[model samples]
Target: MIIIKQYVSIFEPMKKIVVLLIFLAPVLSAQNYTIGNWYDFKKGAISLTFDDGHPSHYNTAIPEMNTRGLVGTFYVNFLWNNSWAIEANDVGHEIANHTKSHDSLSYLSVGELHDEVTAFNQKLENDLGFPIRTFCYPYGNGGESDSVMFYIQDTVAQTHLAARSIAKATDDEHYKYDFALSERDYYQIRTVHMRDSMRSYHEDFRKVISTGGYMTYMFHTIGTPGGWDNMEVDHFTDVLDDLLLIKDTVWIATFRDAICYHRERKTANLTTVYAPFENGNNWVLNLTDSLRDDWFNHPLSIKLEKPTEVVTILSAKQGGIELEYTIVNDSIVFNAIPDNGHIIFDILNCEIPIVDLTVLDETIICTPDSVRLEVNYDSAYSYSWFKDSVKLEADSNVFFAKDSGNYFSEVKLNGCPINTASVGVSISGVCGVPNANFESDVTRQFKDEVITFTSSSTNLQGTETYYWDFGEGSSIEPGYYGPGPMEVSYSTPGEKDVKLTVTGSVSFTDTIKNKIVEIDDFNSCGIYKEDFNGPDFKFWHWCTCKYGYNYTMEFVNKALRLNLTDSIYGEWDNFKLFFYEDSVMKPFDFSDDLYKPVLRVRAKASDTCRASFSLLDTNWVSTAGMKMNQIGYIDLTTKYQEFELDFSNLFFYEWENKVVDSTAVWGIS
Candidate 1:
């Protein structure tokens, strides 16, 4: 409300002034409504938990906590004398399962893990009349195997509300301050050991306060001469005393209660309806959630900012029942039960109308699938959707998004705009489709030359099968899988076809026709020709004698030129130009030919030099070792010239009788 005072006139006799008073209507202001991160809107949270069913826990820890009105979660193994579990449950503390044998779940088989987890749960239900709500890994070891992790996430998660692990969450360095309430894995909740120094605990508490996160302490024994991670009796009492100092701002709870509140608040909804009364306004609060009410009945703390200073009187009620609330620092704070009944509030001398808005879906999704983004819908308020700060055409309360982006919504009420938190959508998956292709080592070669076929297929999404065919009259080399490099040779001299078929999401087949894979007769001179047109080193191999040095070999002027600057073999170094038929040497036969075969070479040299040519056997040994075999030698001049060393013209082709036999030769050098 606004008040105005006006001075009308001033008198001279007694300095009297006439004043006029004016009052105006109250001005409206914006109000913020929020749900506290922790119970009673605490700054941080701590969960006290013990494991291994140590006698010190019941003997020393529980009694000490009971004196301070504190509760803890105790994970007990059935192998020990766990009859004290019922006594722990009788108190306000939580009795959780730590497996029957307390073995590392990662080293256990699938069936053994199932028995270990379910057996403890069954025993707890029979003994305590209720099964365990949360669990702790025996040695903070959930699993490192996919099958075991799957069982814990898919199977064990069904029975337990949440699980705790001493393993670091996300990173190794930040284990002390494990997780914030907004981003924690409920199935694998992270914890810190109690043996860490009190100074470390203080630092962790500070981190929790700053981030509004939860820190869980894992304790095994409470006094000296006890089990693993034992804390002295005095030290344990000091820890409890330290927690009590921050009791107002830090909510210390049992494991089960903490998990229940976190899961409930994650999907809760709060709505406020405003109306005008005689001198003030009325607000009807509706709080609801989507989880099962039987298990998730924990109350959520709500804070409402006072809309105007004129509002002096505040009262709350829910369906003929008075709801207890506090006016702290000029704001109304209360714990409201979800889906119970309407909570009505009456405020006097206030006229502002309030609007409530909240997002319904999760903010982050980690799959390649799409998720629906929804918000609370109301007929009195209009909504506008935006993606990545760009206005979308959607005017409804729900938006179905498949692309990856940041999505948010705006609600317009009483000429004011309110923005809800944004939901980040990320889509991830493989990117391409399967394809099939291949290439042959060479397009044309001799009949006995080896040809290698290699597959150039892409997007082989594991589980695809492959097949290759080198066509008729082809001999396949061994030691290769489907679509792998296959070495094959064409025995017949005609053209042959090669095909590769890949069977997957789409059946793909590629074929190289006979024209592309040509094989000529080895007896023809056409099989032995090298124009040295380009830098393609497909068939020839040049060797320099061991003592020769300072030599260069390259293709120039459409011919292969070898320049030896110096030689150590008396200027008569053995220069052998060997022909490579694919990757292996194959012998060709000309013993039955009507005419004798000839070895020809076009050569030149910077200085006077002699070259020798001979035939090697299948084992790459010189055939000239025998008395009947002979070699061809020639002298080269500076000018390029053609030289021929023809086979001696005599029947039976025996060099001892000056005759030739080509069947024993495998390579020319």
Candidate 2:
């Protein structure tokens, strides 16, 4: 016995049985069947055909088809001649006929139809030396004065060949004949046409093939339309490429070849059972049987009840044969012919759970001294710890890590791996100190001037140890040991780098360049130059007193008697005065205030270049026998413009006048 089963879902369980018969002959290969006969086979088949002898049949269609090693039938008309018809003789391509004028066959009488088809056939045979066996209705019509059905039957009988028309096939047995033949009651064939660019056609092709059934694709012209019924060449090539990729799983052949192959290969001893389970249903079962051979033997029926059910049907070839039953599920049971060959069903609702991990707290900057890691999990039963790739012994919810590395954790549920998460840890330490210097021209002079040195450092987190090297071969003040302004004396002139080393928790050092100091000692004098005749000489005296030089003289000013006193020195010590009024000095008594004199004193010496001083007091007396002396001198001559006096070292002094009564040597000089 042979049996077959067809299920809606491939997931359903199926079974088959094979029994060897006595005196069976072994076949080596597939048997060849006659051209027009039907064949029965384990799997269904279909053929793809094309029509309309458009120019693309050669240029666009053939080359694309050569890529996939596919060939199709092309029905032509006389209008597509040497000027328009594809050169069919050049390639092993078929060319059939539409009418010579492409007139609707339904409008023509049977005799005229015969003349139209035969004339085109004769033209093709004379040109290509081949008999045309196929014909397509122009405008898809097949009738003339008679009904299309009667016309198709008559045409087939007259031509001693088959004919094909356009119709779709369905599983309904009532429409089987209409779907099977070109005309209602004739042996004519009917087929479906598929355009290359139609998405619906590809989807239908996939659906039919996936159902383990027949699928046919039909095409017309293979290029841009010059008339109706046209398709692009590339579109045709794309379809062929798609089909070739699945050629192993699909049967691709000519229309006539497929019809004949399916008819003769049909099996009577085999049956198929289809069982489609409802949505969310837990179980599905299928059973099949093959009485002829194991290759065709398969389970054809599937049973599905909540707990258990025994399903049976009449054997396709025999009756009253009981198959065995078995308990495969807790409540579900199945039956099979052999005890051990029964189908088993399983309905498991298993799903993988999702796990998510997150950090609850914001991350903190990692340092060499401290680090903390915090994390949280959702839908996670447990976790396995890891650092880098090495697994840690403890699998805790959170981990505190101080070392620098990649930290990861694997989640688990009931000891099964789920997902993993990771974080990176980094470490850092404290910064260090920097240095200072200075330049100057003084080395060792009191000069009453002061210079200072500053200290600096980096990463001084707290109080730092400041070591100041002043380059003076002396240590800093006992109490001063940090960054501050401090004075040091350089009695000589030079350059120096003050080094400051700041050591806190972190140690650092820095140096500052060219701390300079300078000192000098020089003296200058001032004198007055007068342009007077040389031989005629006059005596002039210059003096610098505390206030200035004083000489008493009488003067009359407009009915008033005025007494004038000469003071030579200015308020500052480094100045000199010149007495150049009337070009000469008038003789006057030194002991008595009798000589009125003007004195000029120029600047004598500078006090440290950056120093100044105010006059304290001044007095004037004769240069004779008065024992009066100036701390510095000023000469009245052309070369000595002014007298320069260094009173910076001078202290306070007093002088008095002395005279002999008789001759008066202290008289005017």
Candidate 3:
């Protein structure tokens, strides 16, 4: 007793066409004997067929099909090292003949055509013990000339059940050939050449079901090189995943199986004997046909209106051999071969299998993590999983979920479907709340040097706003949102407090304050440059006047102006401006060079006056004999003129160590 229950049964109206394409052995069945147009009585049929002996057929295409438990037909060449075809055949995939060398039949002579076509079929049959049943034209070029077409067709018809040709690689409605079983010609069958578009495949699949016609997809290579047209593996997998949704509506079979079933169904005959058993319905159906059972042995799907009071199929058998059957609401479906003997179905009001689904993992998942969902394992039924009212590709009882949606399972017990309650799974972080943060490339730089600041905030929902403030005196004003890495520089030297604020969706706001960035007055090469038009001067200090003499240094008209007055000291009144930070000149790297550090000052005296500026030692005393360190007393005039006081022609090598105690002299008398 060989029984396998792989029929499809989803909850739908009786008018909704349902079918299954499992490659199970033929089973026996119910009272009504209306033969399905396609296998399992599907609305339409589809066959994914590939050409050539490309390695990708074995490496990529075969594994993907096997993962879905779907099958395809591969037309291979005998001339190439085509050993993978045997393995494909062992796994129930069709391996037919392309040709010996795939030479175009139009260009070949009659003798050459026979050799090209028959030799491949003969060789494959000898190796596999089963005659090769289908053929494919290389590049879909069957024959351009009439004579060539006639010879190729006559030769192909002898061994092949069908030969598939091409009908452009597009979704033009004209190519949608009516595959209504009896309406199609076995030879010269038109096919759609598959390209790298998942949308096109989807459209084609939907059209096949709507028109109730057969659709064949022709491919050369998948996710590999060295083929005329190559499709991305992702596109191919996406098409397959989508096809799984309607696996119950459309019959996905090999070219040979579809041809055999349709040809046999055309002339099939059935005799039904309906009799009432003990408080239930009983059926004994005899399915037979005129075609040779040896050649047309493919099982045809039988659908009947299920009896209402019959809750269980008590027994189903063929010629005293027990068989399997499925009970869809109002429709009992199962597979049976013609001339397979008497198929008996006994319906009873017995208890049926009960199914329950459970979630095996957490209901709340992180953004990247997934949860596992499963149904109770039952060998008596098959399963179909769904999410948010859409069918999923998972057919097994278990499924791993990464996306957030309501998930449930449809358990089918011998064609009777029961849907479980939906379990909701939610992702934790979706809105992406704003978290404000930033980083600068440099902590301290020269006044004119630019610093780059980049925002490193999280939870950005694409509409987040960014605000950056690079402290006062910066080159840019604090305004609305700006993008990073923001280049900012300050004209005034000080410790700058940088701030970054981000406002995300739903009025979520966050702000972060970065550490202080110090801007220095001197350049990298230890050169001091300053303009005293400032709110603050970090390098200069105003010392107390000597012995009650008053000296004032103030910003008058944006310039540092000095005023001296004395009541006691009279003409001896003097004041000196010293360098800040304990008289240490900052950035003092004037060594190993002939740099004679010149002081350029723009000034004008109120009267004819004398003044001297010098570099003082650590004790605040001027270097008297240090020519390179002193600017001698020079006469000043009323008119403001730029004065360049060049130091004596001497390289100050010792000044490299003067960062410890160096000071500046700015005394006026």
Per-prediction backbone clash count: 3, 89, 3
Sorting all predicted structures by TM-score, with the top scorer first, yields 3, 1, 2
Point to the candidate with the largest lDDT. 3
lDDT of 3 by residue, 1-669 (tens): 443343221211101132334345443344465777888678888899998877888999999999998899998886334346767888889988898888887788878877888876898887666768888887667722244465576677666667787644344353343443332255667777786753567877888888776778887889875556888899889878988998999989998898778767876776654544632456667887655455557888888676566666767888788776777767777788888887788765554457667777877765566788878888887888899999999889888989989999988777766778899998765454566777889786666668898888765668878877778889877866555888888999999988887876755655555668989763111222434332232345343323432333333213333333221222332445543333344532222123334555543343424433333333322355332244356544544344554432323334335623333465544
Per-candidate TM equals 0.43, 0.31, 0.44
RMSD of each candidate relative to the true structure: 30.0, 45.0, 28.0
After TM-score superposition, the amount by which residue 499's alpha carbon in candidate 2 deviates from its true location, in angstroms, is 99
What stretches of model 3 exceed 4 Å from their correct place?
A: 1-32, 79-83, 143-148, 169-177, 180-184, 197-199, 273-283, 305-313, 319-321, 329-331, 346-669
TM-score of 3: 0.44
* Candidate 3 lDDT score at position 644: 59
- In model 1, the worst 10-residue window by lDDT is 8-17
Order of models, best lDDT first: 3, 1, 2
Off by over 4 Å in 1: 1-31, 79-87, 107-112, 143-148, 169-184, 196-199, 273-282, 306-315, 318-322, 346-669
The top-ranked prediction according to TM-score is: 3
Model 1 Cα displacement at 59 (Å)?
0.6
Model 2 whole-model lDDT (C-alpha atoms): 0.42
Query: Which lDDT values do the candidates have, in the order given?
Result: 0.63, 0.42, 0.66
Per-residue accuracy of model 2 over 579-608 as CA lDDT, tens digit each: 222565432222221222223232222222
